[model samples]
Target: MITIERVSQVPEDFLVDNPEGGAFYRAYGRAGIPDFELGCFIVKRASRPVTTAPFFIMKLPLNTMMPPGFLKTLLGRIALRVAFVGHPSADVGRIQGEQSAEVLELINSELRKLAPLVSYKGFDGSLGLAKFNKVIGLPVPVLNLPPDYWNRLKHKVRTDLKRKLKASAGLRLLETDGLPKEHLQRVYELYRQTCDNADIQFEQLNVAYFRESAPLSKYVLYFEGDLLIGFHQLLCSKQIMYCKYIGMDYGKSRQYKLYFALMLQAINICIRDGIRQIDFGVTSYAFKRHVGSEMHQTFNYFQHRNAWVNALLKRLSFLLEPDESELR
Candidate 1:
């Protein structure tokens, strides 16, 4: 019997202890990091013990409309004994194991039934696995900036950095530790402005998120003074560092190449510390390419269950147009 349960938390040990499982689970679904709601399905047979698998779970703030009562009631009627709740992205669906022909078909059937009430999608291996004309992602590459690379930079890049350093006034580059409260507030302001310029609307992040992750993560940079002009966050393992989030005052400092300096600084730090790869995160941003970083494509997999909705989705997919002129 398979029982699905809504878990308040997906233990950290579970993710670290089961690398292959974690990778697999992340491929089909993500409960998301810290404080997001996640669900797991425990499968058991008459003789075998319980084994937890990533089934249908929600990340959060996305599928808030699907209440707990509705999910529980629906699951009870089916053979499924448990259900993970909430849409971390407002994307919901049923999750199964290493997707086989039969398993996908079965999932498709169940989704067909829930067609009217729910929509299903996921972050799968589709991106790395797909053969595309443009970009592809490998396992997050561990990178360190090569020594002397900075020396060979175009005269323009070097001049920009020098100019900024000279005029930085009271700008102090604080490491992840000892970052002051006022500093973060300014960084967040810069980040918000950047998002606005890009016409991207993001869930507002509270100071708590920055305060909590800043010191804990390996790289958190902030340029502080009258303005909180720059902020960057990096996530890392022993060998790999992900340039997770960054905010900067491009308008005020665009000509100064403050962002470039920040990126180079990250690379230098990584090299010094023996960190191998820097996953400058998603975005075909020109600066990322200028840093000699390659591009990787991440994809979303949407599977609609109902015949009507499935048909509806196919048409919608056809209508899907590239939102940007160049995906960088």
Candidate 2:
């Protein structure tokens, strides 16, 4: 028999045996967002711990991905209070240790008591539960750093990247363990711009998130003379470096190819620091792929407390995919 315990905070040593368990949620949750209430679920069988999965309570905007028009405008305001079995900002949904279909179902059952919309978001692996309204959320782009990583790309990609790198060579690169409050404020502004330009905005990470995440974050900041133009935030887990968030001056992007430059620089850092893989994130498939990022599929499995509402959600699930025409 399995039992689930929901709590606002996990025990300090809860992550000791299960290192991957509640850390991300705990780290990012410290500086909380208004609508997002992050929490943890402790699962046990016969008093022995099974695993710890992170969850959050929030009002999820159901029409977050719908195209801009009359219908999107109309339905966009319909936010549903949801209990999500995943982290608010992390790329992967980690239900660490012994996650079978039964475990997921039990957790789902427990979460539904909190809200009508209970979802399992951003899991790359199967939860093995067929009853949920399964949908393809977004595919993450990952670039692996193998030997001779730079030369392996297509000649034109390499040439264009090299030219862009050279043109932007005058820009100074500052690698910092953390950003000061002044820089953090500027970074937050750029982050808002990046999120605003995105087709689907899942979580609007607040400025407090930047301040709280600063200690754990490594920044690759770009400056042209004295002006800060672009900055990329990175978080390392074992040998994999996750390119978590980026803030850029888009007006200067066309001239400097800021995105491409940052990506190439990340590759250089990986080669230098012995990091194996760079998780580039879910959007910008074309650019990420142009630079040799492989597509890694991620999924979302959802269930509504009401049967009729569950069926309707499944039917309207096609709106979750990125609505990119040319795949930028």
Candidate 3:
């Protein structure tokens, strides 16, 4: 037998207990985005007493001009489906063990009761989510650091890293708990520019998120004299260090190769700390691959509450989701 419990706020100890429940999700919950509610689904099974997954419920807006009638309700449903066509309520946790399928189905079944559609985003493909729906191959590049890390890299990569490090003579890399309010605002502007230029668009981060989550993780800031040219936010779990968020000034990026330099710095940090893997997040595949990173596939599994909508999604899944080519 299985039971499910939904709560508006997750307990503090829950995050501490689960390795998957990290600062990113906790910070996202505190971001206070309007119409978005953060909650967790607790699944209790006969074999395992408790399993929890955090999710974001995004409320769809109704058209004010629509009169209060059957037509309004009908249009509202359509609008909701369309608004969340590509994006569904996101589940941010991993399901492990032999009963993983049953556990995932239970969580999805519960989520379907509240939202018309639900998705588990960016999970490991090996977890058997493909049985429920079409599993897309969304791979993220990761670089594994061996004991003799620098020598393990290709000769070209090692040469470039050294050259970039030497060229970044005046640039000082500072590891701090957080940036000042003004510096965060500047970083936000740079982040906006980076997002605007991206081929893929997703959630936008606010300054509040940066401020609230600063103490939980390490921040690496690159300064060219007094000006902040770039910054990288890192989150560590066990042996892996996730490069969660990064932003760089375009003008300074080319001149200083700020992105590559920051990446090299992250590698050095990982090697020193004995962190095995550095997850370089999605996108910029070519550069990441060039630097001896191996790609690991991530999957997003989704289901719709409505049968007709679900059928439509099965046929047009490519159109509804992000194009894989866009990343390349």
| Backbone Cα, N, C clashes tallied per candidate | 19, 0, 0
lDDT for every model? 0.45, 0.78, 0.66
Candidate 1 lDDT by residue in tens digits, 1-328: 4333334333333445322224323422331334432454333345342443343432223222122345435533332111222233222122333444433333334433433322223233432211111211112222345656568768887676556545543457666643466666776676667656542221344455555555435544545444557767655565666565567787755644566656766777777777666777543366566556655443344433345754664464422222342243
RMSD of 2: 2.4
Flag the better candidate by lDDT, 1 or 2: 2
Off by over 4 Å in 3: 14-23, 45-49, 59-93, 96-101, 126-131, 180-182, 320-324
Compose the digit string of candidate 3's lDDT tens values, residues 1-328.
8887776655555556333344455666777654566677667777454766766666433332233457546645443421121122122334333337677677777777778777666676555553345556357788988979888777987887798777666788787655666677877777777767665444567777777666666778888888888888877766887787778888888888888777778888888889898888877787788778888776666677777877776785654343545356
Better of 1 and 2 by TM-score: 2
| lDDT at 147, model 2 | 67
Best by lDDT: 2
Q: Which has the better TM-score: candidate 2, or candidate 3?
A: 2
Clashing pairs in 3: none
Candidate 1's displacement at residue 237, Å, is 2.2
Tens-digit lDDT track for model 2 on 70-162? 877888878888898877787678676778877878888889888998888888656786678777767888888886887787888889878
Q: For model 2, what is the alpha-carbon lDDT of residue 29?
A: 75
List of clashing residue pairs for candidate 2: none
